[model samples]
Target: MIRLPDSSGRLRAYTPVGKGGHGAGAQGPAPRSRTVFAAAHVVADPLADTTPEGPAAVDWDATLAFRRHLWAHGLGVAEAMDTAQRGMGLDWEGAAELIRRSAAEARAVGGRIACGAGTDHLPATGQPAAGHTLAAITAAYGEQLHTVEETGAQAILMASRALAATARGPEDYEQVYGALLAQAERPVILHWLGPMFDPALAGYWGSQDLDTATDTFLRVVAAHPGRVDGVKVSLLDAGREVALRRRLPEGVRCYTGDDFHYPELIEGDAQGHSDALLGVFDPLAPLAAQAVRQLDAGGAGGFRATLDPTVPLARHLFQEPTRYYKTGVVLLAWLAGHQEHFTMVGGLQSARSLPHLARAYELADGIGLFPDPELAQARMKQLLAVHGVH
Candidate 1:
């Protein structure tokens, strides 16, 4: 039995369900029903002399190995996304390296891969000089876009904090995105990451009102047809996403980023279902792949049965202050033995409190996410003891 601390500072005894729950070794052909991509996380080099404000020190071997694990489970790897700490600890240079390396690895393993491209090279804050200008933002995005395209991977146009900070109104957004869309070498996935994921993006698409903002968003897409493969909606509003999915132009897919309601969203009604590009999938890849395979076999009920139980863990990992969700993600990765240390780019491992992490461990353990529950339990104990929980 392991003792886990609750929010109330009380310890609760829990026994791990151990191995043979939901095996992580399950692998198969990619799901034909939905195009799913797990936004993967980067492993930090724990021994590096790194600081919270410094450029990320990535563990290239372990990081690439984790991507291979995701690919082995028949999941597309969404590399260098927010889940990889872009705009947080990872700078533009690091992200470029990651995109190139992971894309090459994906080709070697015959795995599907898409990479995020944004103006993260520019300082997020609006500068008095070139950084604040729409042209500068566009140029920054172009540079990153070129990098991803050269790697022969699909480019995901990630929501930009720089654009959010600099755009004067919807027209500015339209102009900037319009320019980028026109120059694309291939159809790209547009990401609408809600402010909940990053507070700097509160008034994205030129309006604080979601209705108005979504209007601007659609106009941009409507202006550039066929250039967009899909829009990855991370608004966390299932109803809004459904509405948006219905409104998208023919051939434009809606990849759901809603961690909370994915089971139902993916298992849609008569209208249609959203494809997935979710951060939660990083840790849930094995079971998620199995569930999608079930969907492919026309067993929606089985898909729900397999995936519904995982919602609690997803909700917990992506709780309020949602951007810090990466912490719990890397934690689970460590517990599952994907990495030797529970460290993250930018030292984000300490973002969540001890109680919060404890709960995440309990929830994930309950779902049998770990390949070896004993290793997980031992890790959890070591973490707790470090915090003086014993």
Candidate 2:
């Protein structure tokens, strides 16, 4: 039995259910119903001498191995996404290397992969200065786009903080995205990450009003017909996502990035369903893959039965301050034995409170996510003991 701390600072006795042996569900064919990509987390080099402001020290082997694990479970890997700590700790150089390595690995394993292309390389400060012109922002985006396309991997045009700062209005956004789309060699996924995930992006699409922003966003997509494969909506608003998806042009997909209501969104309503490219799938990959397989087998009920129970866990991890959600993701990876340590790039292991992590462990264990319950329990105990929980 382990003692876990709750939000009230009270300790509760808990016994793990030990429901193991669901680890290797990735052997099945890809899901035919929806194209799902798990935005994976990067493993940290725990032994490296690093500081928060310093460059990210990634454990590339472990990171790539985790991608392989995701691919083995029949899920496409969304590389260098926010879940990988882009803009948070991972700089553009690290991200570029990650994209190259992950893309090559995807080729070797015959796994589906898409990489984020953004202007994160530009310095965040003095973004509105003379040096940070729209042309400069466009060039930065073009550079990253070229990196992704050169790897023969699909490009995901990630929402740019630089553009958000530099653009004066909707017209600037249209100009930048229009140029990038026109130059794209293949259809790219466009990501609309809301301000909640990154406060720096409050007025994305050139308006704080979502309806206006949606209009601008759709116009961008409408201007480029076949250049866009899909749009990833991370506004965490299910109704808005449904509405926006319905407005998308023919042959374009709407990939749900809403962790709060993914099951229903992916299961979708009568009109149509959203495909997925979620950060939550990083820790929930196995059960997620299983649920998608159920959906593929025309077992919507079974799919819900498998995935619905996981929503609470997903909501907990992606709770307020959703950007820190990556901390909980890596913690679960450590507990599940996907990575050997609970460390993250930029020493983000301390991002979540001990109680937050304890609850994450409990919820994940309740759903039988750990392949070795005993190992998970032991790790949880060690973590608790380190914090004087004994």
Candidate 3:
């Protein structure tokens, strides 16, 4: 039995369902029915200056090792993405090193890898002229894009907070993306991170209306079919994602970054299904890969059965203030023994309170995510005791 704090701050004891088994190790080949990438989180150097405003001090070994664990489960690695705390705490220099090291490591093991390219290096202050800002954003994207290609990894064009903060209208977005697409060494995945994830992006694509934003996005993709690969929709709204996916040009894929409604979206309908590049996949990799494998083997029923139970955990971890979801991701990593501690870049371990974390523990355990229940319980007790909960 485990004791947990409910949403109202009351402690409740419940027996954890113990059916969840160990990781489905690299027992088979990768899934073929759908392309999947787990947007991995970085491990912080707990001993470093990991304060809220301090520079990120990463545990490189642990960070890279987590990538290997994802690959071993036959899931591709989406590195240097939001899951890695790209804009939150991980600065451009750190992200560049992460990209280079992860790409080299992927090559060594023949693992699939893709790295984010974004204009996150810009100075945060009063902007220059719109044209100049656009030029600067373009240059920033170009620099990151070249770096990713040089490392021999696919590039995922991350949505730029700089661009969102600078652009005046849809024409600006068209100009920026159009220029970047034309110069790409290969097709790249465009990221559309909704405002919920980053409030700064509330009016992205030059319009607050999602329909207008979708039009602008499609226009950009339609303009450069061969140079564009797909768009990762992180809007969390499954219906909207489906609508957008159906509207995508021929041969362009939709990599679902939606955490709340992934199973249904990935399961898809007769129209089409979403491929995945999800942050939630970091903690749910083993189960996610197993479910995808079931789908590949023509057991859609089995796939649904395997993944359905995990939605509650995913939704809870990705609750409002979704950007802070990395805390829960790292929390699960510690409980499952993927890492040595519950530390995070930017000292984000405190983003969610002890009660919220206790709930995450309960949900993860309910799904049998922890290989050793006793160890998870002990960790929970330790954390609770730290919070003055005896």
Candidate 4:
């Protein structure tokens, strides 16, 4: 290979004509014609790292930069959610700061953005001595909701682990959510995160049995249809999400967070399709936006063609022990050149093994996710070297 110096004096490897980024160079229009929101994540700051048992040290510059990238692609940014590592490494204080910053940034560029509002600041079992169980959770959620609303961004009422630990049955869910929704400044998006994302939320609606949970969740929405603008279901259960969406009252959008099975869910069956607000989308934003734009063009074949190749890659990243999926997410971002490094809060880059990462890279490359294959390959080499592999 011949190395040529460019204007920047950086060595550029000369390869066979038409063998570089020249092919599938830029993101093309998405094939499927539809509107699917991509929940975006922060680009970790290279300078900051997460303490094992503490809040994350976010790189504000890189963090917001990634959101800007999402807006540039005509996708809405869903911040302060699990995608951003909320409740994982992002504490309420950090989350509030993030919501404010991202919301302001979104305003500057006129970007469509929504953020998560949950009772994460409070303890699971109950609030402090002064804070009542219901009131504490309510107040914590209200604080985040107010923060999000103050920023002029929409609100996503993310499920609460605090509530999960306290609630006795379906009625508790109804009372908590019903009252909260009734007093909302505007209609808010409701979120039902399954155990997959946070196991503590298992049987979230009321019972360990899924059927009971579904009934309870739908009933709450039905009782207060107007206050609920939409529901984000992250169970990774395609059939259940679809079934629940089908029963949703008119005007209530079902934003699917089923990362493992989103392509088909977004595709929709005979009944109707789901709009998206998935975490997998944080890293896959550009590609996802391009795909959705294709669907918007009424290209069912094109949508599948573009996204189908990506499923295996997504599945590999979100494989069992799914909570650590963030590692894969950050890894791909580094490979794709979105982030400066492959490190994450809690040093989660080591969460997955080298073999797991090797497979992820292979799948992502085969699907043409990297705009610059050479960059990706170089980054892969760097990651391997760090692992003490020559």
Q: Across residues 1-390, which tens digit of lDDT does each residue of candidate 4 receive? A: 323333344444543122233112344432344545667666655575446576677888888888777777777888898878887777888889999999999999888888999988875444323334777677777888888899898999999888887777899889888878886888889998888878878778779999889899889899996888889988888888988999999989898888888889888878899988877887677667766776787787887887777788888888888887888888887877877888777567788877787767766776667767888777877776776555
State every prediction's TM-score relative to the real structure: 0.98, 0.98, 0.97, 0.89
Candidate 4 scores a C-alpha RMSD against the true structure in Å of 6.2
RMSD of 2: 1.1
Which residue runs of candidate 1 sit more than 4 Å off their true CA positions? 19-23, 124-131
Q: What is every candidate's alpha-carbon RMSD to the true fold?
A: 1.4, 1.1, 1.6, 6.2
Give the C-alpha lDDT of model 1: 0.92
Residue range 332-382, candidate 3, lDDT tens digits: 999888888888888889899788898888889888888777777788788
Cα lDDT tens digits for candidate 1, 1-390: 999889998999988777544637588888999999999999999999979998899999999999999999899999999999988899989999999999999989999999999998886454523347899889988999999999999999999988887888899999999999998999999999998899888899999999999999999999998999999999999999999999999999999999999999999889998999999999999999999999999999999999999999999999999999999999999999899999888888989999999999988888888888888899999999999978
Worst 10 residues of 2 by lDDT: 21-30
Compared with the true structure, what per-residue lDDT tens digits does model 2 show for residues 1-390?
999999988999999888876654546767889999999999999999989899999999999999989998899999999999999899999999999999999999999999999999987676455447899899999999999999999999999988888788999999999999998999999999998899888889999999999999999999989999999999999999999999999989999999999999999989899999999999888888999999998999999999999999999999988899999999999998988988888888889999899999999989888889999999999999889988
| lDDT, each prediction | 0.92, 0.92, 0.89, 0.78
The number of the candidate with the highest lDDT is: 2
- Descending-lDDT candidate ranking: 2, 1, 3, 4
After the best TM-score superposition of candidate 2, give how far the Cα of residue 86 lies from its true spot, in angstroms: 0.3
Q: Which lDDT value does model 4 have at 124? A: 47
